[model samples]
Target: MRIIKAAVLVAAGAMLSWTPARADTVPEFRGNDTGGIIAYELAHRVDARQLAVDHCASYGKVAKFLAVDAQYGGYVSFACRWVPYGASNQPLRTLY
Candidate 1:
């Protein structure tokens, strides 16, 4: 019985984590940025820090990824063409 209860709880927790959470408020950034958001969402599933550092300019060039189209869920997100949120609010605007 205990094992079954634990499994049920675990399954519920997993489902909750997978459930998508929309933002309650949107930012004022009006740009057609989609690369970062797309990459972030995809990158999030797997641990690809090294790939992000080498491929993602925002990760290395900028410092933070300004999420223009961010999706909320069990975690926070950032997806922008050029906005700094990491590395103490610094960005690599020159790349974009």
Candidate 2:
């Protein structure tokens, strides 16, 4: 029947036009030797900080928090600085 064929076409069109929703829950790091920025959701702040620390560690430095922006989900700015004497390059871990 023409009605059935029209219904099928409409369904197919809708299916073709469907788009999946996107939530940026993953932390993204962008930095260089001097400093870097991390974009992430609030729930992923810890992950972002850890990523910064790891990146700075690669350069034999430590990560220092500079600023935070809550717009566009969230962002954390950090600078890589030399590790002072008697200071550990590793981030402090809490045992729960």
Candidate 3:
């Protein structure tokens, strides 16, 4: 039983390593709210993790209504949550 478990674990690790890397973003980034934002940011960082903003802008670059919110590691700071577009505000949407 122990040997079987070890073999299974080894197989799982091997499969994970075999997972192909895409030209786009990481698992955290995608199409909607958290998903889309994570996807775009991951793609941006795929080359070099360094970002221009202290935190991610709201709605990333796609949404013009809400503020921006950046992510570093797992933590998110509020400071620049307001849109840089200035005034003309609306509902916030975080996405690509």
Candidate 4:
């Protein structure tokens, strides 16, 4: 009887300890046209954006905001453009 009880307790403890892997959403940045990416695990959207923009700027270019949208888990998706050839404020979208 004691062996059975010990086995049951061990099984229950194992079951409780074994947790399924979770796919949690995190903050990420990507260029809309250039395909540059910056990823960060930040809790706030504003902070994530700032970190991404700062990372993108470290590549020696300017980061421009194209668009922003809501992502999963309250994260914001930022569409940006890195001005090339030292030309600042270049429009990514062209007019016909």
Candidate 5:
């Protein structure tokens, strides 16, 4: 009975120490200027969008989402379009 208890304790400790591998949550960008593709999980779409916006902003442009592909995971394709001057520069109002 004592040996069985020891085995159970060891198994519990081992189980507690084990950790599952984590998925890559960081967004990855590819391409330049005119357009680009972003690779990321659906769970992290907001981060991916922000990345795209930042990338386009460097080119003095805005990110225009083109498509979302779920094949082989997820991807967001976007274009860097120029934002016209005198356009509404107000902070985005969210209904949330």
Candidate 6:
């Protein structure tokens, strides 16, 4: 009986740990413009940069992705810099 109880407890603990937490709010990309650069945060690096560029478009500016990072649980932060029309810019590269 003790062995069965211990096994059940372990299984219960495992199930609980495996369950994902319910997020109260939806995760969203956030951004800000600083010195002609759009800084952003999101769950994924690619999406973060896209968001920054989109934001720059809203401000009537063209952007090129600069730096990105995704180190903690899909939480990413990135920056986009303005580029002149017809000028080439480096592709987006995630640091991690």
Per-residue error (Å), model 4, residue 47: 5.4
Top candidate when judged by lDDT against the true structure: 2
> What C-alpha RMSD separates each model from the true structure?
14.6, 6.8, 10.1, 9.4, 9.0, 11.3
Candidate 4: what lDDT?
0.50
Over 1-96, each residue of candidate 1 has an lDDT whose tens digit, in order, gives: 999999999999999999777666443222233322233354566543333333345343432344333453322234334444554754432321
lDDT of 6 by residue, 1-96 (tens): 999999999999999999887875545555565313322333333554455556666555555554444444333444445556676753343333
Clash counts for all predictions: 7, 0, 16, 0, 0, 0
* Alpha carbon lDDT of each predicted model: 0.43, 0.75, 0.41, 0.50, 0.74, 0.53
* Tens-digit lDDT string for candidate 5 (1-96): 999999999999899779654566554668698978877564265576677777787777888899988776677899988887799762232231
Off by over 4 Å in 4: 1-17, 25-49, 70-75, 79-96
Model 5 compared with the native: what TM-score?
0.53
TM-scores of all models?
0.25, 0.54, 0.27, 0.37, 0.53, 0.35
Instruction: Tell me the lDDT of candidate 1.
Output: 0.43
Which regions of candidate 6 deviate over 4 angstroms? 1-28, 35-41, 73-75, 78-80, 83-96
Query: Model 3: runs farther than 4 Å from truth?
Result: 21-96
Worst 10 residues of 1 by lDDT: 28-37
| Clash count, predicted structure 2 | 0
Return the candidate ranking by lDDT, descending: 2, 5, 6, 4, 1, 3
What is the lDDT, from 0 to 100, of the residue 73 in candidate 3? 41
Lowest lDDT block of 10, candidate 2: 87-96
Residue 40 in candidate 4, Cα distance off native in Å: 13
